[model samples]
Target: MNRLNLFAPDVRENPYPFYATLRRESPVCQVDPNGMWVVTRYDDIVAALKNTQVFSSAGLRVASEPPHLQRHNPLSDSLILADPPRHSQLRNLIGRAFTATTVASLETRMRSTAARLADEMLQRRVVDFVPDFAHRAQANALVQLLGLDPSLQPNFQRWTTDILSVAAISPDDERRMQDVRRSIDEMEQYMNDLLASRRRQPGDDLVSGLLRSRVNDCALTDEDLMGFLFLLFVAGLETAVTLMTHMALILARLPGWMDRLRKELDLIPHFIEEVLRFEPPVHATMRLTLADTELSGVRLPAHAVVALLVGSALRDEAKFQDPDLFEPARRAQASLAFGHGAHACIGAFLARAQARVVLEELLSRCRRVELRAERLDWNVSLNTRCPLALPIEVIPA
Candidate 1:
């Protein structure tokens, strides 16, 4: 059996070359230590993602059951981890907040929020863009979306960070697992308080909307509400922050692209899509097989763990021309960055809207958001790899 360390720092930092080799030599290979299989080819991953019957989305809670700190335990309840009638029900119920009109309505507020953060970044001697700008913008957008106090942005950062840090760890690592549990407990408490207040005041926010919505005559129970909130808490802002950070790194390299963007504002959306292809925030997602199955001629056992390396697939030579190169104008089909099928990212448009607004601000205000390309820090985990700190200096345009 061939093996690869999905958690290795070097691999996490630059997994493209390794993924190319994996895709060519062994598209479906079993990895030791964790007894997991990896899917490196784009087509195989797409097939797996779309084939929810064979590749079940269950067992998301298994890893975080005991010694693990999980973002959402009993994950079966969450839409991301659910299937069939239940999944459709939840997605339809939550889909209202992200409708095109709703997001368009929020554009002004989102842009204003990004502009304020951009101004703050401009004032800094040397700003760590993650915490200083991208993280702040994401936190603000999420707070308003959920009707939470703006002062709790730091808390959101801590809770999401702690919860996400436990990915791919040994379930027996009790120490880290306990820490994750504590974070989840604290965040859940905060969520409970918010839910109560929303119940009383019934504001015009996502939580309140979910509280009022009933899909197929089904309403949100207390458990369902908490699970849904957990999904948004982790998924809502984290991807946007990472996407902005990745774009900053890219813009720093193509210092002249800012001027190009100014001349052709239309390229902004394409540029964001390319960034998602080249350096997506999420690298992999886990699925358990419902029955013994075959993927790309490789046999997989029933109840086995398989990791769909969509991040690697995004850079597959078979899928994209010059897969390793970052070109802003590349015309291509949608990448698996936002995932596919029933498990696809529901907040995709909302996140993209936030990223586009902030990104426009960046290109317009800064002569170039400068970063030391070679010194970038990345979060190395089983699921995603995101830039940790982009020490950027903004030269006002």
Candidate 2:
């Protein structure tokens, strides 16, 4: 099989080699006869993400318009998938919850939660960072931020994972598709019930905040509300968890850096940013061309699927001085990990805050954290880049 087909399994284990080939040879190469142009250069990807008029986010999933997406109509008119006026309005409404002050307020809680979880995991000697530490921290943070019942945290995580897996599985994978469809229905029902409850007894949370916001003298419709909530649950939690796992894995590899961080705990923020660039939680983002456009001299047809390899872009030698090296003290440059332009991650501040807290707490408590296993079991999905299980041994401080 060719290098592109390697993405199916081998790349999932470690995609850096294939990603390097894509970046070096054909920054805009078509993969596996799919005709989906993979754009790896930093400039090209950023340009595409910024120019929403030419390269739209709409019809992102339907690169080939699968029968399931067409038949079931699973792609909701969510802000992430929508273009223009609708995307702007929805983003504005949801933007309120992620303001600087709002995100800052959650720091104490995030730190305390992280410390407690780390302490508990330390007692056990061996723990899967994904479920025990990363997932717990992310899910709990979302529950507090979104004002959802804490009991539904696991359910929400499961639902979000299934939803993301849709892009990876074959369209003919009936069982997987049905599983995702069922999960979506369950999530919708859960969100509807939560919304109804909030209507009766409002609280000071993201959901309640959205309930109070007005978009052009109109309240958020049920579909809009559910879609926004779904987006938050997926984007808000998943990325953070993935970043946390990546941080832990990197720290294990670079023990000296971990030791330095443990001493100068204040540098945790910079360290997190470096981790984000060196090993981003998200590898790529897909965009559909709204009109025929020339990107990096390659003319793309209308509605063409352009997969911007964000992981490669972050490592582009042209952008950073030592792109591949993880240097926390180096002046931070713009990273495509959280994306750029108008579609930049609304929860960027919140994600940073959470990561800082987690890293600080881990470094402060644990004297040394080492990889207990030889290889990482990474999660393979079209969008999310994360480890399925990260086993680490936390030596006491």
lDDT of each: 0.79, 0.78
TM-score, every prediction: 0.94, 0.93
- Tens digits of per-residue lDDT, candidate 2, 42-159, equal 8988888888888788767464235674333233546778777778887877675446777676778788899899999889978888899999998888878877788887686778
Reference-based TM-score, model 1: 0.94
Q: How far is candidate 2 from the true structure (C-alpha RMSD, Å)?
A: 2.3
lDDT of 1 at 302: 89
In lDDT terms, which candidate is top? 1
Q: List the residue pairs that clash in candidate 1.
A: none
What clash count does candidate 1 reach? 0
Candidate 1 Cα outliers beyond 4 Å, as residue runs: 67-76, 166-175
